[model samples]
Target: MVKRFGRTSFTLSIAFAAVLSAAGAAVALPQLSNGWPYAPTPQHTDRTYTLAAVGDIACEPDTTENAGNPAQLKCGSASLGGMPAEFATARQADAMHPDLVALLGDEQYEVGKLNDFEQSFEQAWGGLKMMERPSPGNHEYYAYTKHGDNEAAQNGAGYFGYFNGHDQNGTPYPQGQAGNDTSDEQGWYSYDIGNWHVISLNAECRSAAFGNDCSTTGNGVLARETQWLAQDLHADHAACTVAYWHQPTFSATTSTADAPDPAAPGAGSPEGTAAQAWWKLLYNAHASLVLNGHEHVYARFRPMDPNGHFDPKNGIPQITVGTGGEDLDTVATSGGSYTNPNLVTAQDQAFGVMNLQLKPNGYTWDYRPVQAGPGFGSTALSYHDSGSGTCRG
Candidate 1:
């Protein structure tokens, strides 16, 4: 006899039936033709993987700004009361034991010098270095002036050296990981993780040391990167794809406010606008998602086409998780109201990491904020968001 049970009671009924069958009882189970009891075919389980991502991390060790003030937006601010905010987030990522860690960008503060990374970022996230797939941010190329004017700009030297290992002949920069910025390579690569094809692009092509032109028509780093991306997508055979970089084409923060204003759309960064070509390529390839940092907040956008129109069946969702211990920024406001119709949800008050559970044909994301220590008196401890989506394939 075939029996149907309510969702809540189905598990119990299955257990009872299995027990009766194991005891060799004369229970009338679902049967096929002839005299044999029917057996259900086992379902195939898809291999799944996990990735932890975040950026805008690691305060400069020498920064004295807000030395012990956890509430202030400065390098020395602490999280969980006593721990450095960056370290707290690192610990959170470590606990997840993810298969991969995507360092969105700006892994180190100031100019991302090798020493700064060694002194600050390495102290916290070093354990995950081997598994990290990194992309360079503007800070890695050109940032605050510690040496003199633009002289302090390591031009991706520090970033590549730290990730790809320093050169043996005393050359400051290395040529692996994201590749040297001084060359046409410009650091764009793709790899497969489980059933997903992951691409990491460098969006800081506008840096003076690289190629100042990010325009689609310019024959610069951006152009070369886009050409490489087109080829990469053409060669990809994965059912699902995700691309990540430093800047975002769709920002969660507006110009007026630090957070997204419901009254208006986000004013995306110029670098992001330059990446529209990338969006077009990925969209044509039916990419599933885009991950980004640099906005210093966590924001999730509804799936949208390259033109920024909602396209549930064909659009790609972009998740910006820049809350990697750097000070968070408020969403931009228009007329004192939050707008940005494309923005689904955003949080700027917390330092956290985003955990992505990647499946064969779909994925789920969970944004977990660092727990505040006793008497921390912060709202970050309460912020959380999670959702699942199917692959466009």
Candidate 2:
């Protein structure tokens, strides 16, 4: 049994109140099955869709270097009492029967070598690969190990090969579904689901494998991506749109100045900062939402503009669902108070997958923590956060 909440009505009431107050009219709202009043917008359609999203999943494969480390050994370890958290989340996501699975990135841990993805992530998430729309994370483009010390991995070659399909002749990099990362082609694309348009972007523009720069001024990889995005958005006519990648421009977790262990890589970090350009494009286009990972925690922020100020009417809300497994991180806090004011809610103690129900004119999100069996230890798997939001017209 999945948990449901009345927060959807609370959110809708706030939004509708502002609209109704401006119009100065007393219009009766139609009630939906979820108890929220429905107002049909331009994006209205009879059909609805569900998406399961998360990232930073799958542990490092058990190798000579990863042998004794419990973090790397827990991918599918039955000794941990029950199914590993990643596997549990996978099962939870499978149960939803989502129309699509958006993998925010870092699907494979450590260096994301093809062998590791095969040994670990494949066992846990391969079942959903057919419907998955994946993006690359920092781990996928790392030429060195996860510690940033050794150089034993291919830069995104493994990632490209896995999702894009490998060649029978045994090539280091295969170009197919994910596009050619080693060349000028890049790996950003968009598609439609019902009335919504979804985009998957590559955030590893600063990686040496790309152009080592995310500036949109020159003919760099990210610059081209920006150009493509502008064109993509300009051509899109969807009433609601969403763009997703790994890092976020407005992170929910801050540094030690605000919290203990920083779950995110700081909203001021280069990648996060560079992402503002993308946000500007999306915001200007009236995008509905932005999904991201790389934080190792679950956080949802109030709708805000590209500059990070609250903009409930036209701004885009960002949801960080990085809690797909791989040891969770602590949310930033000072004396038990959250650091980021825009953060609506955050949980760091449990691994979970976010189920997004995309309606015609709006959407509802549910963060379902993975339920652990008897052997899964004392993880707080009962934590939940859910709400609904209307799309910008």
Top-lDDT structure, candidate number: 2
**Deviation in Å, model 2, residue 72 alpha carbon:** 5.5
RMSD of 1: 16.5
| Regions of model 2 farther than 4 Å from truth | 1-45, 64-83, 144-153, 172-175, 180-182, 256-268, 371-379
- RMSD per candidate (Å) reads 16.5, 11.2
Q: Compose the digit string of candidate 1's lDDT tens values, residues 1-393.
A: 111111010000111111111112323322111111123222222678778899888776654432332233234444322237778898888887777788899888767878778878888888777667788888888756443323257677778778877767535553444544446656666656667878888888667755677665434667656655665666667777899999888776766444343322224566787777788888888899999999888899888876677788888898999888756666654565445677788877778899998888999999978944333457657878999988875
Clashing pairs in 2: none
Q: Candidate 2: how large is its RMSD?
A: 11.2
Compute each candidate's TM-score over C-alphas: 0.78, 0.80
- Whole-model lDDT, model 2: 0.71
